[model samples]
Target chain A: MTNMALYKREMKGSIKLLVIFSAVITLYVSIIIGMYDPELMKTLDGFVEAMPELMASVGMKADAATLLGFMVSYLYGFILLIFPMLFCILRGNALIAKYVDKGSMALLTAAPVKRRTIAFTQMKVLVSGILLLILYSTILEFICAESGFPGELDITSLIMLNGGLLCLHLFIGSICFLSSCLFSDTKYSIGFGAGIPILMYVLQMLANVGGDAETAKYFTFFTLFHPDGIIAGESQAAVSSLILLAGAIILYALGIIIFDRKDLHL
Target chain B: MSIIKVERLVRDYGGGKGVFDVSFHVDQGEAFGFLGPNGAGKTTTIRHLMGFLKPASGECSINGLDCWRERDKVQANLGYIPGEISFFEDLSGTEFLKFIAEYRKIGIQNRREELLERFELDPRNKIKKMSKGMKQKLGIVAAFMHDPDILILDEPTSGLDPLMQNRFIDLIAEEKKHGKTILMSSHMFEEVERTCDRIGIIRKGRMVAVDAAASLRERHTRSYTVTLESESAAEAFAIDFNGMRKGLKVTVTTKQSLEEIFMNYYGGEKHDEHGAV
Candidate 1:
């Protein structure tokens, strides 16, 4: 019940940020598509050629070239990943470290609630908030698609893609939650939480560049949530995404267990 | 029956800090004060009682329910006001209070309104804009609004004005009359002296003494300032007073505590300068 309350609060606080980001990104993409209709194919070709480098940089897949693939790669790849990463870091940092930093945990912990309940509620709030953002972004994407910009994208496939992104966000959220448990300082929590995902993103890109190190893709969450893999209808990446999602749950559970036993100073 | 009990509760920080093997008990409906100097483990003990930190060894229980294992059930019966009041700055006082009430699964009802009025808190204001006293009042209101069976407060009056502190004392007195158990941790000796029935003094994380306030004062060395008609009488009384007790020290003084002089001067008066006798 406490978790439910915290989740509601997190969602309430972040809805505006999520809505604004979604509208801005969607509107920007729609305008670009409308103004440069003649150069659309040229731009699409350039985007495809740059896909590998872009994917390497952002830990996305290089194969998204078709209309559906372009939308997923352009919209979901860089924008979706960065936005949720920011949200997860912000939410996770606030949940535990912020409370400790501000001395509010003393007030909360002084209540009859257990430390584990507090930690668990925070994780729940963060994950739920990320889910809300994902839902909003997916709605925006659908709206933009319906407005006739990307005519060939399938709604069902887009839903599945968003679902995969949701799992990936959960993965990142758990990582951030774990970092929060490890670091009592808010600055350290945000730094470490945001740093790890970006570091993993870099690692995945390096592995892609090596080509022979294909197995390294399994190590990073970004590789699992790659837009091209989903658009290519590769069941393997879907399975990998599920595995990463499971890993996230396990990480969060581990954090909760540790937090339950650890002494809190607030 | 003891409403709160701690038996040799050890909470050691990795570097050998915090409370170590400290133990005490508070009977039901008792207003217990936990007195300690800074870093004397008062907050540490309170945290253990709240189940925020597990005891390194031994146990802490509330109404016979283990605080660690039965946390939610134990917490459901508790109202807590922390030493430091750090609320969600963006939320209005009412919003923050409502959020807490919702988590506790209770309706604010009239309790919220009553507390706000009593504390003179404006619930409409954002928490960030409120003064420290106002913030403290908000915390007090939130904690008390639930009307829990037990209140575990840590320096609850740190930021309150003297008038508000007096009101808080009266509130605690009222709560005590209604048979609510209170465990208050504070460095404010006078407040403890005024509000608590029993006082526990902890020094360096170990409980130095735990007894009824009057009894502890009596058992410990009492200070008596005697002002005689002459210096000879004052010197004679000091020697006699010192000889009567093993460790007692007596001092002859020309000056008296203003409170003592005021009481003596106003004795048996029907009307006083302040309009009360």
Candidate 2:
């Protein structure tokens, strides 16, 4: 549905940011992979024993002996999820909504290309960005894990963990992307686009406090991708992955449909 | 055949706003000027023709295709500069033009270069940094660079200095000479008078007058402010021509043209005498 020129242009516009995001994710994942200390792993259970509530509140695992447990608690639970989610919210809003609001989309719309073609092309940019980020971080972390732990790491489980994260980010990105198309003014669109994901992130955090708020975790999309569950090869990873994939497809289709029919006030 | 056609187009924006039952047509190789004051539905009408807005009741088309349904096909023949020019301000003008050309599939740079040189525009500067006139110049080049058959410009000369405005007028004249169809909306009477073969004046979302430029001008009455050597001479001249006299001066409004007729019908303040003028 899209011409090569448009796809290439969209890619060219964001390749710089893609490279920067990949580099940052790779660096963080590599540092986490290298931070596996077997000696520190044995004594780690004592801290959890001392203050179980405080440890759970901060998303710290009591048993951080194994490399997988350390990474699940130290990296995937917060930094990795939050970083990609932020990237998706920012870039997804910029991809469509900001362009339409600023009248730059007018320039593209005046051309021979269809609105769907423009949309699909930008979607490629977004999907490719997420894919490349995952690819870079996974490869870099794999190399670090192999050298640091030497065959002790379950490679398949690690791949599944990253895959779950990818699906989660795509779902988050699509929410922002859809919100961007829903309104003409940036104030409203940006409010919805950025607001929803941040709300979900906060809900997940409060849910982890493990009291009355524990049930609130069920409400957020984040509940699907439990870092420790993913590293342990739990069923939640597989189920959440499917749900995120379905939600992402629906939101993206809605974005294109609304964008095609809505009046461009520009 | 008409290159651009708008029929019974009504788009109510609420609170008594938006265009109402607007209808007009511009034939092939004809320049039609749409004249209206601020908020008089000129831009709305142009946007309809551009397929940017869907009418509430009626429809508009270019080259016989439905404006909304077949906009992609219709846009192939159209070149436009929106009322408010907006661009990718982060990119330099040259890059932005190149991006448009790439989308337009115009591999040749001659026309784009010629337009840049004609407008005295150096498209190397960032669009955010460019002055309004320069951005307007860039918009003109981007629109004309493709050499489209139809041009839809809304207030194309609003931000430009007078010299650039004249340059734009000359450009339109050249485009007109090439047998191109153009619909331009503007507040300036002289530019429309100079370039358009026919002119339509719209007021409050309603088209008040439409006529051939030559006939509209020839039939219009002229206004002359004459100074007399004597006070009695002024009063005598006023009496003779049905003009008004004040302190040795006689002010006589000209014959009513299509413009005067429009104003007269609306009973505006500037030209108050309806029957007398």
Q: Judging by lDDT against the true structure, name the best candidate.
A: 2
Which portions of model 2 show Cα errors greater than 4 Å? A42-58, A234-236, B219-262, B268-277
Lowest lDDT sum, 10 consecutive residues, model 1 chain B, at: B268-277
- As for candidate 2, its clashing pairs are B220-B257, B221-B254, B221-B255, B221-B256, B222-B254, B222-B255, B223-B254
Please provide, for model 1 over B62-140, each residue's C-alpha lDDT reduced to its tens digit, 9 standing for 90 to 100.
Answer: 9899987787789888998876678889899878988887666676457788888888888899998999999999989
lDDT of 2 by residue, B139-245 (tens): 99999998999999988987888888888999999999999999999876777888999999887788878889777666565778989999988888999989999
The structural similarity of chain B in model 2 to the true chain B, as TM-score, is 0.84
Q: Work out the iRMS of candidate 2.
A: 1.3
| Candidate 1 lDDT tens digits, A96-180 | 7788778787656655566677788787777767777788777866665667665666887888888888889898889888888
DockQ, candidate 2, vs. native dimer: 0.66
The top-ranked prediction according to TM-score is 2
- The TM-score between candidate 2 and the true structure equals 0.89
